[model samples]
Target: MSEYYRILGVPENATAEQIKKAYRMLARKYHPDMNPAQDAAENFIRITEAYEILIGERKPPQTKSAPQWSARDIARERAKAYARMRYAEFRRRSDAFDIPMHSLLWPRWVNYFFIVFALFFITDSILPKNTIKCDFRIKHYKYFDACGKVYHLADPHTTVEGQPTGDIVYLRVTPIVGFASSYYIEGDNQNGFLHIQDSPTEYIAAMYVLLVLSVLVLRNKTKKFENKLLIKFGMCIVFVAYLFVYFIWR
Candidate 1:
């Protein structure tokens, strides 16, 4: 009957496969276990009844106990039910492949990298530049050594004044020179320096926090070992390239 077909959301000429598919899809959506809507149980009963009748598994109920319903009212109800089913199907498909905002730019790991890098630059710009005054002796024409720490003169003849104090001379120290080594120390000397500039400890700590958060999020969200490996590889490349450009290139 037209009413049975409408209840199951299938065409009257639909094949057995189409009828079964439609029934299953609608059943899953309206099933009491899956949907908690106020009328879900009633809709589920109708779906089952329609399915049984269409498949010749059961006969339609007698009209003696059935409530009288006008054709216009039935048509309106069918239209509403079909609209709800269509909306549910669209929502299910959307949820199955939900895309994250960060994924628009790159993978999660790359997004983490860019976010942390951007924060570093932003904080660096906000914080006042700091410098440390230290004693250095001219090691070469452009190179200088302060205590055991060695650095190339940023302005050579212009920044340093007068003569060296014996073999040692006083000069301003700014660690992690150049654009890429923002979080690392620059000079060859590991010790001996005066406080003149901002300490990189906070910036480095922020980066570490970002790294740990990214790792935790990735561990929870991704199950594939290859994906984890790719993320690690990308991080390694970022570090290696940073070091190579700023530390080795100089």
Candidate 2:
């Protein structure tokens, strides 16, 4: 006798849950809406039949525990069930094969967060627009803790064009135009790393520290070559962009 399990691609011993899962997956993949194969109608009928036999319908009248099935009937059902199960397993394994191992580490949003923050930070910090004695205020729809509102103070680093040094509230930024590099704010009250006269050594030291930390994080089972290249390249671009913005602001 032909095995209905083979028709639906499920295991003979498949539990109700397993059978249901397999049915749904195949149903979606080979639904009338999706599959236009020559045998699609026949295949659908086979699956429908298997489902009916396995999960028999309930009726108020003329009820039965199980169909009076023979050994041949049971054997055929088991064979069909086993076949569907193997097919489902094959699909699962095939999809698992395509994905690289390391990608499984962080969630998708985590990668997106790093990328977005990186761009925003690098852009805003390098070409700052603040000068000493500049007015800073934070406007808000309504005050949050009855304290400070969202302030738009000049980020101390943005300097006036052709007028630096001897300028009060002297500020300097690195990866200077803001592409790559940390921001430091130096004021009479707030002494940040950004100073009027920053040494090259100071910048290199900071960069090396940050880079090493990042490389360590990337040291996982699935090392994406493209990601590594992007980090290195983005850093260089940030550094150069920083210089451009720094001079432009200066």
Candidate 3:
């Protein structure tokens, strides 16, 4: 039998209003007087019959025997469906880790942070420093903390009266980033004066390099990778490198 739903172009669960609307639209388009096509009259008759049967105005036509399916045919169809499903899943997983070109180096937030830090670095480096006279003492013969700020000296060996000196010195501090850029010590004779200079430029650059490496190693939306052991090893390497650069190498 002809499917009433297919003839009216409406689903089986279509509401009465929906079926009526579909019948009206199709009838108007396929009416013999409106459409001069030869099949228009036949289509209009079919839609009219479908509308009557669906609205209980007439009895439905008798249906034919149902098509039979063998076990082998069903299994073959299932296997084909399974293969298609697996292929779709494989595509999704394969492209999960594909990083975009813009975010290849760093994420959006990280990029913004780098820009702010660079601006601060440049502004602090250019602006005139606020020099404060404070008593500087050598700690482990490498660095000293003065006025609640740490300073790494370029040359720790300063002679006072022809000996290793530890005395009050000028602490040059920048306003923006509050970095202690350089320092100088007073001398009795004009020729005996010492002005040692050091900056955190190298240390800051090293820190940024390490941060970039870290982002490359760990950045991913899926939080997964094929090389589990290699990823952990790379993270360890980054950690060790950061420590060495910040403490010993900086």
Candidate 4:
């Protein structure tokens, strides 16, 4: 009896509130879900048992050989099993959610999609392609028209001492998807390389990578129950805010 009080760090004459406070503090420090120490689980169970006994919710059973299990004991065992299952789920989910590059948890379609997208970008960037030469005219400080296509200069002010009225621009269209190919003006300047505005090859590849990572994070299942609820709440707020800004605030 004295040992139980000591375990909870409460006095024998301690009030119910004091006992509860002590139990809660110890539980938070030792609960298996919060604490990773090997002894935390044991300490948590001990503190819980002590708290129950001190609160008169459970009696100290007499020790004997081959003691029959009570209904309460059965319930406790079931609860422990449930806790273990939840812990395992937490571990598995945490790992899966931490990385987006690859995971077995992803569906077949998702895996295939990632593979196809990765292959396309990799092939596009690596494969050899012929260059097309076209006469170009600088339409604006930022971009130029070439072969019926618009190409944004990397730095118009620095790259162009002056925009040539009829400059020859060469284009290396991507072999696979014609996406993110390089373009350059035939000149002495090294920075005469041109790209599509807001959609450079590097930017396109990076956006796809970001999409992959987002998918990985969204696929996280451990926090699924809470995240789904939160996502719904968050999306509602975002949509409402967008509508307000577009229709009323503006």
Candidate 5:
């Protein structure tokens, strides 16, 4: 007689709960829908037959003319199931040790760090402008801002003309927010200083508003039309920002 308990991977004296649990776990592991093995259908049938017999839902064939399913017919299937269970148990143990495979992409803290970085920049842009004081030096008739970016003298006669090379001049600077790093400089120049600003304040304000709207849309369960609208609006903001930064803001 084929050992039903051995085929289902349960003890001979296993309780009803144990039998059911074993049958279900093995069935899910070998079911044709979940498994792609060539012999998955055969193993699934064997698992079902074992469960039915244990539950008293079906009787084993007893007629001599009926085909008998021997242990040899399912030995390979039993071995495959056992190997898969062992692998699954190993993975579970590894997961318990916090060694999951997905950590290869990035740890949880790294994702949080990037989120905080983005929020910091956004908040900085939204806040009021602040004055930054720094000692400026003339280099090759150009001025280097606090961020080390060089700018033309706008009116060379006002500052750089006849000025000693590498002269250090103190200046108070105000940054123009959301306008691609443009700044207003005022200091010890014969003429008042050069002021550079762009007309992207409206675009910057609209982008921020769209970003907030997209967040709200994602948080709520909305209709399909609203979801599509949010996506389109977000894309438009991104495209406009790209155009302003690439062509106008430089």
Candidate 6:
């Protein structure tokens, strides 16, 4: 059998375009009409075969001059190529998936930041007792019971007979600018609210105000990451507020 590469008259490294060019040039020269000899017919067949193998509809195999792969070696190389393709596909799927570890863990990291700020607010709000003394009976109550129980009694200050009277009195204890007089009425619910000065008791009124005046800030669209961040921030605020309330009640 004639060497196909030598028939095509090209190196093993020639590309498809080069092979086609070589085949066309040879076909025109060795064509049967141009050469009447028996050997000329044989060369025509070989040239046609070479062109069919190189540039036909089916993709050609590697050049005839190239070394062939053994059965076991060919199988092993194909297996390696399949494995690389599968690995790349797996990586793409993993990147697109909503893996809880990556999605949840990262967004929760924002909570720690807000917690530090809440802690600062708490630490500043919690001040230690003053070293100085207080002058009045309630001043003693304030100094001692400020961090403990707060006593809320009924109608501590009032006015009657066109004069400020006892059981409930607004004592003007300040100079024209500087004294702190404080009292309040029990709310209609009696426990939900109390004031530091006289104010009308309308529990339903206050609830109405609370409902109308408040705004809900819910930016969390149930996105796992964003919800995690919001929950963490909420927990920090709750924890700080609880600590403050605890110290106040103590």
lDDT of each: 0.55, 0.45, 0.58, 0.62, 0.53, 0.42
lDDT of 1 at 55: 94
lDDT of predicted model 1? 0.55
Q: Where does model 5 exceed 4 Å of error?
A: 1-29, 37-39, 55-123, 139-250
lDDT of 3 at 57: 77
How many pairs of residues in model 5 come into backbone collision?
Answer: 0
Across residues 113-186, which tens digit of lDDT does each residue of candidate 1 receive? Answer: 65576456446535654444345566765555554655454432324462223443444323334222221123
Tell how far residue 212 is off in model 5, in angstroms. Answer: 4.3
Clashing residue pairs found in predicted model 4:
none
Candidate 1 versus the native: TM-score? 0.31
Q: lDDT-based ranking, best first?
A: 4, 3, 1, 5, 2, 6
- Lowest-lDDT window of 10 residues in candidate 1? 176-185
Put down candidate 3 lDDT per residue, 186-208, tens digits, no spaces.
Answer: 54233332333455544455445
Give the best candidate by lDDT. Answer: 4
Reference-based TM-score of each model? 0.31, 0.26, 0.43, 0.39, 0.37, 0.24
Estimate, for each residue in 28-71, the C-alpha lDDT of model 2 and write its tens digit: 76655468887654565457556666666411111144455454
Ranking by TM-score: 3, 4, 5, 1, 2, 6
- lDDT by residue (1-250, candidate 4, tens digit) is 8888999998889999999999999989987778999988777777877888889987764435335755557357446644764677699878655543233344336545544555565567678866778886787777767777666655543244755444777877767655435577777355655555543355444435534544543564534545544433443343344334324311
Better of 1 and 4 by TM-score: 4
Residue ranges of candidate 2 with Cα displaced over 4 Å: 1-77, 93-98, 101-167, 178-250
**Which of candidates 2 and 5 is the stronger one according to TM-score?**
5
Pairs clashing within candidate 5: none
Alpha-carbon runs more than 4 Å astray in model 4: 1-106, 156-160, 184-199, 204-250
